[model samples]
Target: MNWIYLIMILLATVAGGMIPMLVRNLRPNLPIYMLAFTGAFLFGVTILHLLPEVYHELGHEAGIYVVLGFFVQVALQGLSHGMEHGHTHLPAAEGHHHHVAVFPLLFGLSLHAFMEGIPLGFNYSDASALPSLMLGVMAHKVPEALTLITVMMHAHQPKAKLWRILIIFACVTPVSAILAAQLGQHFELVTKSLAYMVALVVGAFLHISTTIFYESGTKHHELSRKKVVAITFGLLLAFLTLIFE
Candidate 1:
């Protein structure tokens, strides 16, 4: 079942990267809508599901780790140029160019994916929690992968190179999950450590989700009606998933 989940994740990642390449004239507003929906869903999952579980397992120390994770993501953005949060640093107009270093960008995105996988692979809380976590990760990954491919395309990376990077990026999380699961079986202290890691990820989620909200708006920080509707739908879906879970 875990293998199945991993394969699903990998396929979703690759498919996301393929989308922008397949469709030349993707609607300008599409990514913004995606960002709003996934942001709200991820935020809801972290607050309603992950935080309570981590705090229950690790107590106040978990809060400190959450803060650390938040800052860790802040630092990671320097390397990733905010790719994980749907940022494509494309130039504004025909005469301008923005240079992106591919290696650092891939490294940062891989690290973020790896961290997210740890709690899921280790079964941080229980079997039931996996569904919610998996759903959130999948929702987030599509826009993220789209951003990655878009950035690489703008940078004039070769098609083969782009595919290679996308494959590597897609594998990172599944590999991390498998590795974490193996480690948990061997180490007695894995449970507590897993709780702390989950706390860290919860913090990362909070940062990414809120950042989406912040960036999804106009100059006045007001959301457009369509985006607001998308966000509401996402929240409602999250709530329903929790109820059923």
Candidate 2:
């Protein structure tokens, strides 16, 4: 396993999760724009990098898994309450609080993180796609971690427990990557299905990204100017990665 991927993901998660707790006076709506940027980047990366490679390697069969992965994410949101796509209510702003099930939220996000780590563990047909995948995951994780911590704060969880939950959430992907590498080594068949795994993950990415865009927009599904700019910048960055790579 490349330690760099683990380090990068961990740093991004810790920073994102910590920011909400450390800075008491954050702009309540800031996560919306960040989600917009990350959502657009993930959308672009899925189309530009992941979808094509999966189709090229797995052919039409990849389509089924893609659909499955999309619905799978839909199911996950039932458990996560859309936290994976920045569905969070900041405690600082809301006058009242509701009971948020901490376990279900963590389980859902951890599972999503684990699936995202699969492609990182093995070399697929188009090795170039790996970097873009890593970047997409890292970029998205920031907002995800932020969303999780924000929700926990809204639930009025203890600070100590919050830190522990954040650390555990941060490690899920790296641990999954390490386990995937080991499984592939012991069982050759694990590698043969890399394309399917990639396709499924791409599906999950598609679902999350699109949901972020849909939910982040105005009630009429129109984007504010600031959100438009952030999204444009994200897509532009994703495009640059393709050209430069």
Best model per lDDT: 2
> What is the Cα root-mean-square deviation between model 1 and the actual structure?
2.0
> Which lDDT tens digits does candidate 2 get at residues 7-85?
8998899899998999999886688899999999989989998899889888899999999999999998888778889
- Give the lowest summed-lDDT range of ten residues in model 1: 88-97
Backbone clashes counted, model 1: 0
Off by over 4 Å in 2: 88-95, 217-221
Each candidate's root-mean-square deviation in Å? 2.0, 2.3
lDDT of each: 0.82, 0.85
